[model samples]
Target: MEVRLTREQVLALAPDAASSKAGAGLATDGKWGLLGADAEALWGECQGSGSKPYQTQVDLAGLVSRCSCPSRKFPCKHGLALLLLYAAGNPRCVPGTRPAWVDEWMQGRRDRAARKEAAAEAAANAPPPDPQVQAAAAAKREASRWSKMEAGAGELQRWIADQFRQGLANLGNGFEQDAQRMSARMVDAQAPGLAALLDHAVSGGGRDLPSLARLGERLGLLQLLTQAVPRVESFSAARQADLRAALGWPVDRETVLREGEALQDAWFVQGQQLIEHPGNLTERRVWLHGVASGRAALLQDYSHGGRGWDQQWRTGYSHSGTVHFHAGTVPLRAVASEVQGGTASAVPADDTFDVAAQACADNPWLPQVPMRLSAVTVAHDGQRCWLQHGEGTLALQLAPMPGWSLMAFAGGHPLCLMGEWDGQVLHPLSAWNAQGEQWERSSA
Candidate 1:
């Protein structure tokens, strides 16, 4: 089916204001040659400063942009210009047979999809394995893991009780070192999640009683996990999964796909942000707000060495897909089971921050929650920003670069915006004007 994108949607893909302006400048027929659009793709050649005109194309089905230009910014000016021209229904973008370059890209995507389907079919039709043998092997592994965890928990319990007896004032600076050593023991026992909590506690170095109290709470949670691990089989499936995750067991993607609940909806790609973690790993969290279900979902992707993740979904885009949710009490996190089609469309957003906060109460363990506010003006005290809507205000806690970008887009005017709210602060990710003008900054 043929797909058309709006001007605001095209601008939302721009990395910055300069790129938006430059892309708009190149949208005219005078700057482009050999533009064409088929049911599934858009292609064009943009005359640029270089000797060779840049070839640009958009895979409408996947909302993926490609350009034969050196610019690293996603959906570079040439690609956006091609899209804008197509969105304007320019005569040059009339339906035609795709060129070699376009057909090659399309074929690659189709081949990958076909291979995935074949693999899934093969697995489904394969004979069942010997259940008895599998169960015996799994039981043996579980027993060994339990033994190590038991020992580690015993050690941690003794250390925690000893700290209380010694008293915080008497422990001196060495107390922090003791915590780190215990944290290392937990890591050795394969409880990296507990290790992380201990690391976070000691990182503050008892600067305040409130901080110490927070540490106590984390320790309490760890102790609870230790208790739960021994009785894991007795707990419900969802609770067991939650306990395992809290104790550092990794989520099994295959298991989730095989047994997890699935929901299909028009998911609005609200916002995304990157988080730095220990061990040279970086995580990108993307939020999707469901249009029909009125539920939120989180897509977490990780990369090593801080290289950064590619733009999978742009802000202000809508993706119709099937999502598989992990086993949990509040299933806000999910994996995209199938991405059918992605388009730029306006989706309804909750206007009040309170409503968003209430929704997060279902999954209180989440560090951040997705929120959307309508007609909110950006207020600056020359230091930071506050999203003011009527009588309420939510502070924006963003890094220098994104803070400036948000300010430039807001310009003291009210906007329909989407962002991440971390209880205390809001990080604005994208904004749209009344006239459908859009500005998005997905990084940081």
Candidate 2:
């Protein structure tokens, strides 16, 4: 436990305090801490003699419980001292003593953790998945994705049949346009499924039996997409988003981004979601952060094809700030539900569709988790480089390799794959799509 520091020791450790002698202490209500010019709250508990003065700490999100000590737990005095030291510009953090109060709390946490371990061990020893139950979930996911894909395939097939009945002369040209639309739709279907279709369509002249087999497979996939609706309620919200993407549902992110592109304006982060297809593919997302008004806009790149690709993307969720779309040096910015359009809402609600398992039954609550992706550069040889994201990075022979997506970060290191970066911590971007149940951590 940390020794109680005298007021003098606290001030001595604070180099930024304009005056070394502190005013009477109770601003923190018995918690002796220091406030800095930068507004970070820091308090010191005295440590061993005088060799070490004060132990400072900064806030880390999503891990700590709230501190009800009158101080905003967000940047309590502990955090202030941390900022003071950090602001001094040295990146190192020193180990310091924990006061009695904090120590007591830590002990209680350890006890609870031990209890949790016992409970988990008990759960692990339980029986295997009821084959019936496992079958049910897998069946549900497959059925769902297959349904939509079947419908899309049927619709496309009908269109093709109609063209054939009309005649084959202009069929090729019509097929070209149709293929382009289908290609975009495939992208919406979360990539892997789309890739399968593309491979099928491009590999054959339609009369080849192999191509025909692929066509049938695409139809089967469409069926899976169609059936996913009923199963949406059965899976977690996040899985539902992924299943939807697998089924080819549109995220409409491209719409928001395109408007930002045309006007070169800022967008709000309304919502974010991620989905995993059957293959090595995974998606990332960020809800576009929003802005209310004014007129300044960021410029962007124009595709020679003229058709904008924004509508296809789902909104991204994390991140804040303004970005110049077309500018090269600046990394990137985010999405929008333009508050200027009137509503200046903070943290947009998750819009990804949720098809939970028979909400008709008692089950667990599952929500979609937004996918985070970063484009990183990969080095094949000392001299060669390729920008990789998603599965590409996973397939690489790099060191420690990379993590799955921006959604998972480890000790300041990026965890996910995104195409396009050759590895210089570039602006990470995501495809914003929705899927369901297929990636549900638990069916229940």
Q: Which prediction has the highest lDDT against the true structure?
A: 1
RMSD of each: 6.6, 23.3
Model 1 Cα lDDT, one tens digit per residue, 1-444: 233678887787764555778899998998887889888888998877889988888888766777888665556788778888888888878888899999998888789889999999998999988999999998998888868877787777777777667764466767777787899999999878667766764665664777667666656655665666668789887777666666677677778777778888998887765566678676777888888888788888886642323455666678888888877766767888677546777857467466667755654444467778898888778888777877488788776777777777777777888887755668777778777777666532
What tens digits encode model 2's per-residue C-alpha lDDT throughout 1-444?
122334433333321222121222222323423222111222244232345434433222112322323221122344333333433432222344544544565566568779999999988998878999999997897666656555555455555456446544334545656666765664554434543444454444464565556554444444444445455679775466555444444434464455434333345433322334344343434334334432222212222211112222222222233432221112122243332322222322222112111220121111212223433333334433233444443223222322233222222233232221212222222222222001111100
For model 2, the run of ten residues with the poorest summed lDDT: 435-444
Give the per-residue Cα lDDT of candidate 2 at 172: 59
Supply the TM-score for candidate 2: 0.22
Q: What's the true lDDT of residue 425 in model 1?
A: 69
Query: After superposing candidate 1, which stretches have Cα over 4 Å from the reference?
Result: 1-128, 150-154, 157-171, 205-234, 276-281, 304-311, 352-363, 375-395, 415-417, 422-424, 433-435, 439-444
Top model by TM-score, which number? Answer: 1
